[model samples]
Target: MLLAVTRQHEVAANWDAASLLADGSVSPEAGCRELPGCWGLAQPGPGPGDRGPCYAVPAAVGPQLPDGCKAPRLVCQLHFTSWPDFGVPFTPIGMLKFLKKVRTLNPAHAGPIVVHCSAGVGRTGTFIVIDAMMDMVHAEQKVDVFDFVSRIRNQRPQMVQTDMQYTFIYQALLEYYLYGDTELDVSSLEKHLQALHGPTAHFDKIGLEEEFRKLTNVRIMKENMRTGNLPANMKKARVIQIIPYDFNRVILSMKRGQEYTDYINASFIDGYRQKDYFIATQGPLAHTVEDFWRMVWEWKCHTIVMLTEVQEREQDKCYQYWPTEGSVTHGEITIEIKSDTLSEAISIRDFLVTFNQPLARPEEQTRVVRQFHFHGWPEIGIPAEGKGMIDLIAAVQKQQQQTGNHPITVHCSAGAGRTGTFIALSNILERVKAEGLLDVFQAVKSLRLQRPHMVQTL
Candidate 1:
C-alpha cells in the first residue's frame, strides 16, 4: 500500500484503498490517520501482501514536519506549520544527526529523507549559509562575512529573521573557530549585543571612525570655503601639481647612475619590467633624501612628493638637509622639491606648490595636478603639522585641468591602501559626476575585487 503523510491543510485522498491518518488513528480497515500534537510519525513499509497506496495527514496546518518523524515509508510528506515557528533551533545539526540515527537504528534502510520548514526559505536559507561558511573556513579561504550575508539576503528573502539573530550567528562563528565548539561565551554574547546595536560596532569600528572623521572634516572645510573664511595661507598652499614618470626609467637610473646594486635582488620591484611605465616618488631610504630627489630631478619630471609616517626615526634627520626650495631644469622639463615639515600625512599641499614652480598661481586660475599619493596617516591620527592628503588630491586635480595633463599617479608601499583609496575616490567622483548618482558601496566593492588588500590600516 502507498502511504502519504501531510497536514490538515492538504487535500485528502479520495481513493478507497488510501486512508487518512490524523494523530495516528488507524482506520477499521487497518489503515492509519495521524493528527496534530502527534509526537512523531513511525510506520511500517508495505509487505508483498499489502493491498494499495496508503495516505496520512497531520491535524495541524502550515509547513513543518512533525516533531519526531523518522524516515517514513511513504511516497510523500507535507508539513504544515506556521511561518513564525518552522525549523527547530539547531535544525540543520539536528537533521544531520537524525539521518545518522535512522541509519544506525535500521542498517538495511534505504530511502531519500525529505523535509521542509514554513515557506522553505528561511530555514532552508540558514542551512545553506551555515554549510557554505563552514566549507569556506575549512578550506582556509578568506571570506568577507558581510559579503556573504549580503549574497544570501539577495537570494532568499527573510533569510535572516532579525539583526540580533544575524549577530548571534556571527558570534557563534568566532566561538566555533577559537574553541572548536559551537557553544557561546560571555565575550561573544557581548559582541553580539553590540552588533545588534550597529552593524559595524563588532566588525569595523576603526574603519567606520576613520570614515566619519574624514566626512566631518571635509564638511567643515567646504563650509569654510563657502563663507570665504578659509585662511589666505591656505590659498598660498592650494596650488599643487603631480608629475607622472615611467617606473622602468627610474629602475634603470637606480641601477645605472645611482649604482644601486640592490635593484638586482630587491623584492619590491620584482616582476617589474622595463616596459612598465607607472612609477611614483620613493620615500627617504638609507641613502640621503637629496640623492633620491636628485634622481627624481634627473628623470626630467616637474613635480615630486613623498609620504612619511609621523613616528619614523629618519623624518627629523632627512628634513634637516633637504632644501627648503630648489629647482632643476632639463630642456622643457623643470623639476622641483620643496621642504615642508614631514608628519603623518600621505600628501603635502604647501610643499607641492612651493616645490613645483608650475603650480604657483591664483586659486581661481591655478590648475591642480596630483601625482602618486597614498591614504595612510600615523597610527594615532593625522599630525597637526601634516597637510591633509585629500586636500593635496584636490589641488592636483585642479592643476591637471589647468595643465591639460591626465590624472595623477597614485601608489603606496605595496600599491594598496592609501594608493587604492586615492584611485577609488577619484573613480567614484568621476562616475558620480557622469551618472549624477552616488553608489559608495558598489564603488568600494568594485575596488576591493580588483585589489583584495587595498584598504589595510596604517
Candidate 2:
C-alpha cells in the first residue's frame, strides 16, 4: 500500500490514485484487525511481496490531522519520511570528500536532488554551502568559505554549529579554490593550511612581486660616509676654498704659508701670490669658453668649488676641471668670512652631475672623492626603485675610496629631507655594525631640531 503526507494539498493531488486504491479503500473507523491482507510487523515486514496491498497507520495523531483519517497514501510508491535528526560531526577530510561527492552526484541528474541528513539544517546546510561554493569555483567566481558560511547562517540559523565545522569547511574550500584540487592533495594543501595557522596569514602575498618592485623603486640609499678635514701639512696647503667671484670669476683660497707655490702654479694658477689668497677671474664671465681655462690657471687649485644653484655654464666648467684634477668640490657650507652675508656655496655642477650620473674617479687616483649630504628637516620621498640615487651614491663612494677623501657631500632638492634621512640611516646602520646599537631615533631627532622633518617614513 502507498502512503502520502505533506504540508501542501497539491502534493496529495499528484499522488497516483489508481495504484493507491488497488486494494480498495477502507473506512476511517475500520480497525487494523478488520483490514484485509494487513500485517502489523514492527519492522518494514520483509519487502513488498510479503505484505501486499496493506498500509500501516502511525498510532499517534496530532490535532493538526483529521480524527477519521486513514493511513497516509504513499505517493509514487516512494516512501517519503520526514528528514531525520542527526548530528553531523565536523571532519575536515570527510567534508572535503562529501563536497566532491555532491559535485559528482549533481551532474548525473537533470532535476534537483534531495539532500538531507537528520535535522536537514546542520549537515544539509553545510552540504549546500560547499556545493554552492564549488559551483561558484566552477564558474570562475571568487569567494571565501568563511564569508560564504556567514552569509548562509544569516539566512538560515544554526548552519555551522561549531568552530571546528567552520574550520573544516574553510580548509576544504581553500584546498579546492587556491590549489585547484577537487580531492584533497595533502602535500599541496598543507603548505597553505599551515599559513592559516600563523599570524602572517592575514597578509596576501599574491601581488607581493608588484609590491616589491614598487618598494625597490622608492628605496633611498642611506649609506653615506663622511669626508673629514684635509690631511695636515700639505705642500700646496690643500686649496679647499673656491668661491665664485660673480657669474664667471671665482676666488681661490688655500691655507696660508704652505710653501707649495711651484705646485699650484704649474697645475692651476698662471699668476703667483705669496699671501695665499687670489682672485681667479674668467674673461667676459659670459661668451668666453677660454675663461674656464683661464680660471684654472689663476690659483692652480686641484678642486673647483661652487654652489648647487649656479648656472649651467659654471657647472660645465667645474665638470671640465674635475677630470683634470681628481675630484670637484660641491655642496653648501656657511663660514663667517664676514659677519653680515652668509656665504652659502653649492657647486652647481656637482649637483647636476651627481643627479645625472654615478660618482666615479680615475683608477690612478689613490684619494677617493666621497660626497656627503646632510639634510636638516623634512625627509624627502623617493620613488620605488630609486636607481638614480643608488647609482649616484655608489659613484660617490667609489670616487671617495679611490681618491682617499672623507665626508661625502649629500643633499636633496632643498638640501634636507631626503638628504638628512639618508645620512641618519647610514650613520645608524654604521654605528649598529660598529658598536652594536640599533637605535637611531634620538640621533635623528637631534638632527631634526637643527632642521625639522628629517625622518624617513617607515
**Top candidate, metric TM-score:** 1
Angstrom error at residue 155, model 1: 31
lDDT of 2 by residue, 90-178 (tens): 22333443344334434443455565433334445666676687787778776667777788889877675545445545666765554
Give lDDT per model, in order: 0.36, 0.33
- Candidate 1 lDDT, tens digit per residue, 346-375? 444332322333554544222222332333
How many clashing pairs does model 1 include? 34
Poorly placed runs, candidate 2 (over 4 Å): 1-91, 107-109, 182-458
Task: After superposing candidate 1 on the true structure, give the runs of residues whose Cα lies further than 4 Å from its correct spot.
Answer: 1-197, 200-282, 288-322, 325-379, 382-390, 406-415, 438-452
Models 1 onward score TM values of 0.30, 0.21
